[model samples]
Target: MAKIYDFNYKYGEQKVVLPPGKYLLECWGAAGGGGCKITDTNLRSKGGYSKGELTLKKETALYIYTGEKGSNYAPTFNGGGKAMMHEGLSNGETLYCNGGGATDIRLIGGSWDNEQGLLSRIIVAGGGGRNNFETKGGDGGGDAGGDGSKADSKGTQTNGGKGQVGLDGSFGKGGSAVSPSSRENYGGGGGGWYGGGSGYNAGGGSGYVLTENSYKPAGYIPTKEYWLENTSMTVGGGIAEENGKAKITLLQGLPFLVISSYTSEQAVFTAGHTEENKLSKIEWFIDDVLKEAFTTDLYLEKTINYTLEDNALHTLKIVVTDINNMTYEKVVTISKSIMPLPTNANLQDISTKLTEIGEGFKNGKTSIINILALKNIDSSLNNTLVELSEKIKALFDSGDASIENLMNQLIQANNTITQLNSKYKYATGTTEVQKFSGKANMYGGKYGNTFDRNINDWIKIDNLGFVPNIFYAEHENVTVNSVFYKCVVFAICNIPIFSNEQDFTIDTSFSKEKLDNVDFRAAGIVCTNNERDVYINQNGVCIPASNNYFNLHYRWHAIKFI
Candidate 1:
């Protein structure tokens, strides 16, 4: 069986020698006392606790430093407190624990520091800071072990000290003030190694305003409690001796579970223990549901990854058990949300679409303005095209046929069609034309040829000939006192006829209509004379006109420029 040792005192350094064996080392740092007001009773504060296990060799020496308690008023005029520790007297590289600070009027509570060692395995609890005069009571200490009680401000009697036992273990309490009834008041007691003691306010003592057998302040008494069962361990005030050697038993500290990293999608957790082979298992739970469990050796230093749902609150609980049947548990709450991180594939897709749009616009295959307008009208590209198609149909249905309006509509339609064609990569290069072939008569009665044909006879051909362009039929009529003659021509390729271009030609011949008997018998007149005058116009039409009686024959030929 392993022997146990213990140590508890106000302030001292003691050396202990141990043989080769496995042993547990436990330590508790001292706490600072609460500051006192001129008229208020001073209070006492509590300290922190640290423990670990180690293997010792033959002739190993360990130096222990017990921390001192906070003073009522003397040390620094309502100053702070301190904690205890153990050090290697030879190398001075050993485990250390810090105590809570003392509270002054309106000062903050003492802060706890992390334990220091090779394993870096202990956690220190800090004491509470003192309150101001206007405030009623002092603040409580940290929850690492015990919580300190608040002071009373109502009435003349001073309030009692706080309790020691906290959620983890026991620490110290704040002191109380004196009463108004001429009774002596005492400050709260400091925390011991294992447990913390309460403050006292006893009667029948002499001090300030000394009266025989009057109320007076009493000295502080250290308190201790047993944390473990079936062990020879003693804590609190005064040192303990066992088998002519100092007996000290250290409590096993809980393991540390830390969140290494966290995000909306995943979270990483890490667990660690101080002693090797002391841990039995580690279990993880989320929202009361078991996620994973690990059964492994002690001295755990493992990390775990957990996937989380988006935009939700999650609770994580980690339970660790040691080989000694000692268990430690930790819990954390985290909220996750969706992260807007674009993937490579998404970016690539967007880039490809944009490239296509840019190339189409640059090559004039796409109308950027219309496409942009369509895009503005609708967010979806496919839907924008559908809406544009509907709008175009509506535009055409309005039945506005003015040349200017029609031309504008034609331009818009061209742009829209071009854009659509580029988007779908359609082929629209082939051209088709409809030809026109028809004949019209020109009336010679309007001219001086004595013909019965009308002069206003005309014809029009759209998209005609090899080029399938436009052609218009034109005729000129002339009359001289009941005799009429006319010229007919066709304008081809374009509406406006130009001079010297033989677009199409017309030829006409005429016979004499009547002969005069006196003109024939005259010496200068020949009865057989049937000569007529023919004239060609700028539009390439031959016109025949005469005073003689004549009939006419007409023929036309189409000439292509290209």
Candidate 2:
């Protein structure tokens, strides 16, 4: 049996002292503000408990990352870089860099008038590559500006001309604008009339970032910074509109884990964004101890090898400064389990199953969800299979007719898919399935590509799990007149969303008589595939008459009677 270390939120960062006697570990997590709860908490906490304080165990740190990312109901183990990179918000997915850790890196919030964000490094909101009869708006995005042909190569420049509204039509769009200053790796920018090259880290217009504030995004806060480089949002290249705005803001940081203990000739991390930023130079260290430094544009990613010396448990922190000078830090510890059988085969099998099902579905072909769901029960995966078996049995039960049960089965299937997060392109790939276990396959680089995964991050998009916003009433199921106060004072925090509840509030006022009248109003959640809507008391689902709630009396719209 493993020892359990209970957490309590008492300080910003907490340290636990254990007895000398060694014991097995069950579950452990880092305590940020004092002794924090390992489970979940109110909206005031955002319940993003990611940092794992390993009490001597293997996979402990990784579990923390998984938990934190899943806490928001996000499916991506390593984020989509949504916390800091708004350009990544194209799919409205949240991701994080497993490598860098820059100082004072905060999220700025905003929104766009467009249905989705037209954000990229070099967005072209204006006209581009237009002529007599065959021309239109410029390509809008980050890294690359609007080039005529649509090839937004980082170094290669493109020229597009504006179309003439009257008389003679305009010519090709403006030339490609390459970031000559950056001689390093960059994402290819799209083409447009006034186009730029593709490059990662190059903030684009209408580009988005995920950050929280007193209120929500698109709500309008003129006093806020709505545009700039590293400012969460950049101007779009050429968005068509008299002044049509396409705003994108931060939802939260992508969840990530750092493996500092496995530093080989190269340092490495397990993240999805690494492919986005192909690294060339790697600066590594351990507690200020200079471990190594290298430069190679072929693949700027670093790798961590499990060496004999690293067999012992030792705290290690590696700070990687990518080409953009954006530094990332990952802290990891060596575990006792030095060697183990790689599950690449099992993971690949699962991926293949999903791919087949997805392809069949997309092509309007037949799909056996039952068989697909059974793939999760591969006997090789012991415990998980057992748990799933029980759930599957429930699916056939007479009570399975209920919508809740059906939805629960889908949720279980989704969770099963999540377990297939072994590696990207495990088998089917033009390139040898990027060796994440042995090489630096986009663990941290912005130029790294986000390969196709078995399950999409969309499963956990906007996954700020069941946050109970403040309702005027404090008890269990709140009321309608009080529904006006759901997270009103404080926008439910995402990344570090809440410093403390004392910093926020809601409109809680109900007269004793009015409160009595406020019946049948209950707080609950309505679930979709991955998105969940939380409604406080008296909002939607009315509380049953047999309400098991902590009822009380108060002055209607009561003010602190001084």
Best by lDDT: 1
* Minimal lDDT window, size 10, model 1: 201-210
Candidate 2 local lDDT, 126-206, one digit each (tens): 211111011222223222222322233211112322211111111111121223333321221212212222222211111
Output the number of the TM-score-best candidate: 1
- Residue-by-residue lDDT tens digits, candidate 1, 1-562: 3356665542333556654335555444334333333243333222333333443322245544343444333221111211111223345322111112221110012221111210111112122222222221122222222322322211110122232211111222222232233232223333221122222210000001111221222331111111112212111111111001123443343444555554444556655544545567788777668988888533435566677653343556678766666566655544343221233323233334334433432332211222223222213443544454345335434643233433344345445544543433211111111122322232232344432222221121223213312222222323344333333333333324444332332323222223322221111111100112111222332222211222222233333332
Q: In candidate 2, residue 148 scores what lDDT?
A: 24
Error of 2 at 285 (Å): 3.8
TM-score of each: 0.23, 0.19
Each candidate's lDDT (Cα)? 0.31, 0.24
Candidate 2 residue 292 Cα shift, in angstroms, is 2.3
Provide the lDDT at 51 for model 1.
37
For candidate 1, the per-residue lDDT at 247 reads 31
